[model samples]
Target: MLSSLVVSCSITTSELLASKAYGAAQTYPVAPDRAWKIVRAIVDTTAAVAVEERREDGVLIATTESHDWHVATRFAIWIEPVEAGTRLIVVSRTVRPGAFPRALSEKEFHRDFAQRVVGNDLDSHGPKGK
Candidate 1:
């Protein structure tokens, strides 16, 4: 009984955290600067607005409030250079309560945003040619 209770509590805590934030990282065949611009474009269009943008730190943060979902979500993105190309990391966090499911929200959030920016010509015109 004690062990079962502990397991249940752990699952509950994990689920709660998962709902609050989702993170995904991907490497693209592009320069970090180009990747940053593409990411800025995607989030500018999809996110309600960029609450904070820091180019020096290679991070951009945006927030959106949806009346339909009755929730506000923030997306934080990081861009860096890898040996082969550029790596982008995105994390979505919910700032307010809503009807969104807690268990799989982060994965869904990542899928929705990452898919929009990957495998495209937008990054082809990097300052440094590929």
Candidate 2:
């Protein structure tokens, strides 16, 4: 009976943490359409596979390949239009309970995303190749 109670508590704690959002939000100085395109590209290149993508709703859910410690990592990203620009919110969690957290952190994701967006801007304005 004691073991069962302990197991129940562990499951409850894991569920609570998994349901909570574990990412950060950043607003970019760009339109939603442009941000959406860049976000999709980023997810496609990074995630093992995109489980679902809803452009109209501005939501993308993806999963990474399993590693030795975890079954897989899941990412849920949302892009919305804000007064200043587009706001992106990224949430990552482990797919299996008790598995290690192997998903990319919010800061790392934002850094990569910012670099891509800036690179795109630069490429667009640079001199055209002959």
Candidate 3:
């Protein structure tokens, strides 16, 4: 006898960057505090130095510079309370010459944030049949 397994997948463009700024919004099925923690972790982990942080208002702004690569970027995160759960808006900008830096930042940030909230790896690579 032989057995087989099947899986399904979907892809969508939920956010895009414009005007040299990359912005994306996601709603997680978690409380505002929980979402805030995730955002804080991302900022603390990736930021070179925090330029401004407002916990009470649910906002964090950080600036980072890659000395070896000579790339400078700024990050802004906002957490908002919502009926479904928590809403997150992240915006990023690159001071150094680069293309789609903010968009790239948002993509990575969203991937990590979503995976943590859902407790699963969201690797978007095409499914591998086994």
Candidate 4:
């Protein structure tokens, strides 16, 4: 029984490690520069550290703090210009196998990003004073 349990645990760990990274993409009605700025700000606020940034190529890599159950979660974000506007693509995965999944998922990250972008737009164009 112990041997079987050990095998099961090993399989689960292997599967987690081998899992493909997942991502989410969204297009915003804004310029790539604006989108890039927003994304960089968001990463700076959320990530433990910024790993690499390629503004010319519109790529930003960052990692979140790691806890007892999991290693740091790595994020790779890409900003691209589209016909309609700017597109943001975010891919995330665990740095290593862990007992738990990433604290934040790609979809959640996009939601937060969209909210921030819209909020920033409102703040910039809203009423002049209170």
Compute each candidate's TM-score over C-alphas: 0.58, 0.67, 0.64, 0.67
lDDT of 3 at 42: 59
Q: Please report how far candidate 1 places residue 7 from its true position, in Å.
A: 34
Cα lDDT listed for each candidate: 0.53, 0.62, 0.57, 0.63
The CA lDDT at 103 in model 1 is: 23
| 79 Cα displacement, candidate 4 (Å) | 0.3
Q: After superposition, how far is residue 81 of candidate 2 from its true place, in Å?
A: 0.5
- Backbone clash count, each prediction separately: 0, 0, 0, 0
Estimate, for each residue in 24-98, the C-alpha lDDT of model 4 and write its tens digit. Answer: 778888888787777766666554443567788667766666676455666678788999898888876665556
Q: Give the Å shift of residue 75 in candidate 3.
A: 0.8
Q: What overall lDDT, based on C-alpha atoms, would model 3 receive against the true structure?
A: 0.57
- Output the worst ten-in-a-row residue range by lDDT, candidate 4: 121-130
Report the alpha-carbon TM-score of model 2 versus the true structure. Answer: 0.67
Error of 1 at 4 (Å): 43
Candidates arranged by TM-score, highest first: 4, 2, 3, 1
lDDT of 3 by residue, 76-125 (tens): 67777899998878776664444634422777777777766765222232
